[model samples]
Each structure stands twice: as structure tokens, then as C-alpha cells.
Target: MDTAILPLGTVIRRQADSDEQAIRLWLHGKSAHSQRAYTSDIERLRSFVVRPLPQITLDDLQGFADSLADLAPASQKRTLAAAKSLITFSFKIGYSTFNVGAALTVRKPKNTLAERILSHEDITRIIEREDNPRNHAILRALYETGCRVSELCGLKWRDVQPRDGGLAQVTIFGKGGKTRHVLVSQRLHEELCRLRGSSGTDAPVFPSKSGRALDQPAVFRVIQGAAKGAGIEQRVSPHWFRHAAASHALDNGAPISLVKEQLGHSSLEVTSVYVHARPTDGLFKFLNR
Candidate 1:
């Protein structure tokens, strides 16, 4: 494989790079959660098929999809989707001769991923009950910025820039490698700043207890522990904070457009869930009064 110069003198291996190398390089640019999920899915496919790309046919793909019948429908759908994506990616950058993934379709099941909505009081209790500074900062950043687990984990000290008025610009790399900035409130900024002060600008904003970058599982565990301590009965997931952020923001009268942009949602349709997701005090007060 040979190297090619990207814009600004960045170097990357050319299209002729090995299939495994090419896949790994592409995965590196994805958000951490996606990277982990896709890697595991693709590895499963490799183990199941164990054949050369060009020799693999649509029937082979069908058998793989059929094999996942015992799994949840959503898991089956996502695994098939990831397999398709791998084939598509392989063909796109010369890893394969054609995009066979186009034909490997699995019927998506109705989404049963339960959405856990956290109330403002629940959030307060969770925060107060969190014992450590690092986890406290994680919870706060997750709620305040409405960032995904991947985006929050991807943050670096250099990505945060302090402005004149005690606010901070937090740079986030969202899905599809899209970049966006969110301004942190003074209270949130202080929490981040305290951590930032201890680490180099290039280091992770929230490193793991092992002194390396924090993984998604670590963040999830922290949230779960905090929730248990706060006496929340519902199983709390990391994405719940993001949902709560959008819901609470809308409930408190923030514009949908602004919340949409803040959450890095591609369309209003995705962001619109928060509109009706929150509980309202009175729906017909104006109608009656």
C-alpha cells in the first residue's frame, strides 16, 4: 500500500490498502460507540462467512440474515445493516468489486428501545448523589450539552475554547464525522474547566481510571451507579440524558430549531420526538381560560 497526501499535508493510505486495514482506518473516524458496534458486528460476519469478498454472493448474505432469527428483531436488523455497510464501504474504496450489501435487506422490527425520560428533579437527585468529580462532570456535560455518548467521549481539552464571558465553546464531532460547537453555561463551564486544567489540551476531557480515554461502557456504568445511588427505579441508559436534555429544554420553552441544532439532529423529524415526549402541566389552559 502507498500513502497519499490529503489536504493540509495530512497523509493516509491509498485506496489499494488491505481490506482489514481499510476497514480499521474508516472505523477510526467514526464516533466511539459506532466504532465499537460496527467492529463487533463486522467481526461476527467475518467469523460466520470466512470467505473471500468476491466469492461471497447474495445467497450467502441471505443465510447470514436468516441465522440471526433467534436474536431480537432490532438486533437482527442492525446486524444486517452493519453487514451491508461493511460491503458498501468495501466496494466504495476498492476493497471489493461490487456493493453486494445492497441486496442483503432485513425487515426492521418496530423499535422497542425504551425511551427513559428523566425529570428535572431526577436529574438533580442524580447529580447530588454522584460521589466523584469526574462522574459528576460526565453527568452534567451529558445533560447540559445534550451530547451523545460517542460525542461526549470524543471530546478533548483542545476542543473547548473559553470565551470572554465565562462561557465555553465545546466542539463535538457527531455522526458521519460532522463537526458542531455548543456553548457551555458558566456552571457547566466551570466543571469542564476544572478537569481541563489538570490535563493537556490534546488529552481526553474525561480519561478512564486507567489513565487512558474513557470507553462507552465506563460512562454507562458511571451513569448506572449514580442512578442507583439516587434511588431511580428505572434502568438508566446514557442516551436517556440526551433525550432528557432535549425534552427539558423544550418543556422550558427553548425553540425547537435551537434544540435541533444543539443535538446535531439531521432533521426536525428526529428532534420532534422531544416536543411530545415531555409531560405538560396543562394542555388546555389557554383553551379554557
Candidate 2:
């Protein structure tokens, strides 16, 4: 991958015969987002292990997993997964005789649907409070499309098709090089068009002043500030928009299957997290009616 285009903080440190070099080889085809995550996880394992790669044993890996204090369950899982991948690859490539990372097991974390998601009113208030057109558009895109921060940042004007009826479709390139389409609301379509004003199709839809994709941290800071500006007290991450999007769509009667496609999830079960937040089918109300 071109280092120039690599997302911020995803630099591939490939000194010859080093662990970093090995990681670069293993993550060769992964997206920048994936690379950054795995890199952090792998580097964390390095800090935990005192011995060399070949000297590390299964016990060390398990101990590391057990020692993940103060880490979120999702974070714990990814860190272990990364450690396992590194061990497996190191064994494959003769870095070690044993795949120690294989022996480590990660406990699946309970999904907290309510905490990670936003209410429709919350998202609306955040966007409405934002005074900047570009920043407001960014917040709206995250909510409307359920797109990852990287996907939203990577959006280009050419990837959007404005229909005669005013609605627009966006071709989003997601994790693992997969592509999916998201329908933009008429209001959002107009906002995007107004923000895009006369820019060439090749230009980024939300370019930084340097004429490149907006960095993820900047997007995060903007969203966090917007949430505060709108008087939201709960800690909000950019991904909250995506969770909220899935939940809100289903709440509005969008089918589960359609929600799955909108989210580019591989299975309905992955999309089913949104179902946890839905109101009961109103059994009492139905009887009363």
C-alpha cells in the first residue's frame, strides 16, 4: 500500500528481520484501519512479553489475556485475536516452533446495545447544533449511511449518483475491500450537494484543506464536540452514529434484511444487535386496540 495514502497512525514500520517487518508482511493486503488496529494489538503483546518471540510459551499468551485489566471486552477480544494471528504466522514463517497464541481464548463480551447507540433525537440535535456545513454533513453522513469512519472519510464525489428524483446513492468501499450502496435521504442529498458546490467528481466529498480525505481523529473530535454542544452527557464515539443508524432504521419499520445490507454485515445475526434496542412488539397495545 502507498504510504502516502495510508490513513494517519497506520505507518508500516518495516525494519529488516524485525517483528514490525513480519507484521507488515502479514497485514500486506489489509485496509489501513485494520492495519492500525492489529499493529496496536501486536505492539501491546510485545510490551507484555519479556522474552523473545521463539522463547514465548502458551502460558505467556494466556496470562496476557487474563491480565487485560480495565480494557473493554471488545478491545480485549481484538488484542487477543491479534496476538493469536501473530503467533500463528510466526510459527508458519519459522519465527517460532510453537503457535503459542493459539492456546489463548478470548471470552466473548456481552453486547451493550443501549450504551453504544444514540437516540434519533440525540443525533438530530447534534447535527442541528453544528454550525459548519462540512462538519454537519459529516455527522449526518455517519448517521444516514451507517458507514464506518474510514468509509465516510474516503467518500468521493464520483461515488455518489444524484437521481432525477433528488435522492442519491453512495457506493461505499468498506473493510476488506467490499463495496455496498447506501441510499441518501433527500435532505441529506441536498446538504451534500450544497457542500459539494462545483467541485470536480474526483475531489473528496469532504476534503480537508490539504485536498485529501479527512483524518479519522478530526472527524472524531468534531463529533465529540458536536455531542457536547448539543448537551449530550454520555460519552459519544463516531461509531455511535452507525449503531444508531441501524437501530433507528429498524425502529422506523425498515426490514432486518435491508438493515443488514445497509450495514454491509456478513450475517443477519450481526445486524440483529439493533433488535436488542427495539420496543416490544406492543403486545399490550395490540390487545387494547
Candidate 3:
């Protein structure tokens, strides 16, 4: 009989019957949104462990759970859940007989109040305060398109289509690498066209000083600058625009499904958060009578 030694990567693959590779492959197969979340969870767990895989003991798992106390209970629980999934998958594939994550317990965190959304007035003030044409377009595009800051930054000129007889739409690649078409108002479309003429089609729709796509921090600064100039004192971020758009759309009688599609939500459960934020009509006054 002849025995052959496997390559290092192949050795790792055969040791656990490719369990780690299976987990990695499975992670990649998930939506981009899920991949990001699971990767973060795995990173946090790796930080908690003192040794590499197969060397990690039950004590390490317990220590990781204990360390999670510093994080909100909800967050801790979610991270643990992610770790558990990975461990379970590893076990199923014969990587290890122990299910460390399965034995771990997570503490529940207190539920905090929901964050406040920007009012129509606040949005108006922010827009009015933006004096620069580019800044104005950025702000308007966020509110009009209901896109995340990342999606906005990734936008290119080719994504926008302006036609004389049809509604203008912008193609957005949202979380999870999901693509959706967002309608742009005629006014916003024209403004975008003007902005595009000045900044070339190949260039990012929202570019930094270096002409690269604007990063998260830059997007935050742009929103902060606009908010400060508008004289609105509320703590604002790019997500506020998404919240505001969802709220406004529901308030204006857009269907829940339409809102979900616009927001790029995969589930109605996620979109329900916006629906819950809808302002109530004066029913209390009538009900009291």
C-alpha cells in the first residue's frame, strides 16, 4: 500500500473533513448582509479565544460568553448565536465532537427606546442649509432614493436613467449585493443630470476630494455639516434619511409592500419597524368622546 501526504490547505481540509472550508464556503454562499454580520461575529469570537481551532477548550467558550457581558445583551446573544451556528456546522462535518458554542449561555440586554426619525421640517431645514450644489444633490438623493449611505456612495452615472416620457430611476446595489430600482423625482433627476455633466459618467456620483467614492466617515461628515448649517440640533446620521423616507412614504399612503421594496428589505418583519413609526391620526381625541 502507498500513502500520500496531502498539501497544507488540503491537509486542513481532510483533518476536519473540510469542516472549516465548508463553513467558509457556506458563509460566502449567504447574502452579503449575512456574510458581513457572520464575519463580525466570528471575528469577535476569535478575539475571545486564546488558541486556534482544535485547541479551544470549553473554558475558552465560557470566557467568550463572559466577555460578552460588556456588550448589550441583545448583541451578545446574536453574536453567540452566530458562533453556535458555526460550531454546529463544524460538528456536523466531523471537525470536532464538542459543541462549545452550544453549551454557552447568553444574557439578554435591556431594550432601549427606539431612535428618533427626522421630521419633515427637520429635512426641509437640512436641505435649505445645503448651499453647495453637490451637497444639495447628495442630501436630496438620500431622501428621495431612500438608499443607504454605502449604496449612495457606490452609485455611478450609468445607474441613473433620465427619459423624457418615462419615470426616472436609479439602480441601487443594496445590502447583500441585492439590486433594486429606486424612482427619482423629476426635480432630483434634473439635478442629478446637471451634477453628472460636471462630474463624468465613470466617476462616482458622490466622490470625495480625491475623486474616489465617498466613504462612510465622509458621508457622515456631509450629513453633520448639513445638519449644523440647517440649525437643527438633533443628532443625525445617514440612516435617518432612510427612516424619514419610510415614515413619509407610509404617511403619504404608500402601501407597506411598496415601502418594503423601496427600502430593500427582504422581510416584512424588518419593514414593520417603519410601519410602527407611522404617526397616528387624531383618533385619541375622538375615542375620548
Candidate 4:
């Protein structure tokens, strides 16, 4: 902590001096992935600031968000999110007593159409085309458990638990080091058992070609290749599986809270993004009636 760097006057002044260092320290203390995202966000914000941060007016913040509208909706949303984070961080670090960013609003983007889930048939096609047993097991585990690619990559053999004389569940260390249990299908259990015979307990459940834990990009490639082999014309990624699981689970009447927990989301509002309401099944149906 450099006391000389501390600014005089209002909270905003102190924040202008201390906020950048605080944000950097805070980000460094977070997961590497999160650090990368937040760093990019802060840099973008810096580009938008015409004056010293302490001198940035509320109008400037609003104007920056407005300027983002011409970009892709996803990019706009990501930039807005980043701006919100920086503003929030500044407030937390005593840069400003009032949250000027909080008063600013961004338009909500239209939800993209629901992605096509891999039907049992589609799953079968992928599994059949995967000649590598390791790849097969990885896909099965993802499809069966709805684990995020990162969570699956972080998995260890010890995380798999056998119960009732069968492999029953897997303990996943999700984002933020939160742990949750996902039931493993009997077939997946058998696959793990076979895999375990060859790999060590401390080793990654899904290793890369280099024999290290599989990274997110490698997993993405595996899914892409499998989707291509299954004859899916649309691009598919690991996130498609997650969205598919959430949509299917909601369709089958799984409670929203449970789905939120499974997805490791901190807020039910975030989980609601996955629950799609059919136009034909809603109040619109009454109009037709």
C-alpha cells in the first residue's frame, strides 16, 4: 500500500488513486480465467475515460454505454458488464460514495433461440463415431452430468464416489471453488471404472493429448469434432450441453432452484436465463382460444 498515492478530498479522489491498484490486486486473487476477463474489462473502461477517473462524470459513463449499441449485442452486454464491475469496484474501494454507474441503464438484449439439444440418437451417433475410449467417456460424462467443461477438467478420480455397489455420483469443484454432487449414470460409471484401471487417482479424469489436465479449448475441440461427426450442421460447443441440460431439466419439471444449484450460479436470476417459455403455451394461447 503506497500512502503517497492516496488522493485528498472526497471519496472519489481517494478512489481515483487507489482503485486501479485495488482492482488489480483483487483480480489477481481471483481465478486465472476471471482475472483475464476483468483485466480486459478494466482496459476497455480505461479507453472510454477521457479524463482522470476521479473526474469522469456520470454523463460520460452513460455515453460510453450508448456508444456500445452499434457493436454486436453480445459484445455490448460484455462491455456493459465490465463497466458495471469497474464502477462497483470503485465504489467498494472508496473512489466514489455514490454509484454513478448504478444509475446508468443498458438495454437488455433479445434472448437467442434455444439451442438444439443432442437427442439420445444424437448422443448415440457421437459416441459411436468416437473411436477413442477416453473421448467417449469424456462426452458421456458431460452429457450425463451436465458438468461445465472447466469443472469436468478439474475432476480427479477421487471425486467419483461408488454407492450401492455402483459408481453413483461425482463431486465437482465448480467456479469459486464451490463443490456440488452430480449423479453419474451407471454406464458412465462403468466407463470411469475402465478408465481408472489405467489412470491414477490424483490424475485428471480427462487428460489432454500431452497427458496434462484437459484445458477448455481442448474440450471445446473434442465436442466440435464429435458434433461434426454426428452430422450436426450447426456449430456445437460444451456450453450447448449445459444449456441443453438446463432446458431439458426444466422441461422435465426440475425445480428452478435445483437447476441453479447444479449450474453453480450464485443467483436465481441468472438461472432464469435457461428457463424458456414457449409462446404457444403461454398467455398468447389465451388470445387464440
TM-score of each predicted structure versus truth:
0.77, 0.86, 0.77, 0.82
- Single out the weakest 10-residue window by summed lDDT for candidate 4: 1-10
Q: Summing lDDT over every window of 10 consecutive residues in candidate 1, give the lowest-scoring window.
A: 4-13
lDDT of each: 0.81, 0.83, 0.77, 0.74
Cα lDDT tens digits for candidate 4, 1-289:
2111223543333434555675664575576667777788667777877565546667988888877767888778888877776776666666645557777777777677454555556766876798778888888788767788888888998888887757577998877878988776788898888877677778888877687899988889999898898898788888777767776777778898888888778899887876653221667756865
In candidate 3, which residue ranges exceed 4 Å CA deviation? 1-41, 53-63, 72-78, 88-114, 165-167, 198-200, 279-289
Which residue pairs in model 3 clash with each other?
A: 73-109
Best by lDDT: 2
Evaluate model 4: give its lDDT: 0.74
Descending-TM-score candidate ranking: 2, 4, 1, 3
lDDT of 2 by residue, 119-145 (tens): 788899999999999999999899989
Per model, state how many residue pairs clash.
0, 0, 1, 2
Preferred candidate (TM-score higher): 1 or 2: 2
Sequence-dependent TM-score of model 2: 0.86
lDDT of 1 by residue, 89-128 (tens): 6666655665678877679697443357788999889988
User: Any idea what lDDT model 1 has?
Assistant: 0.81
TM-score of 4: 0.82
Query: Which pairs, if any, clash in model 4?
Result: 12-95, 15-95
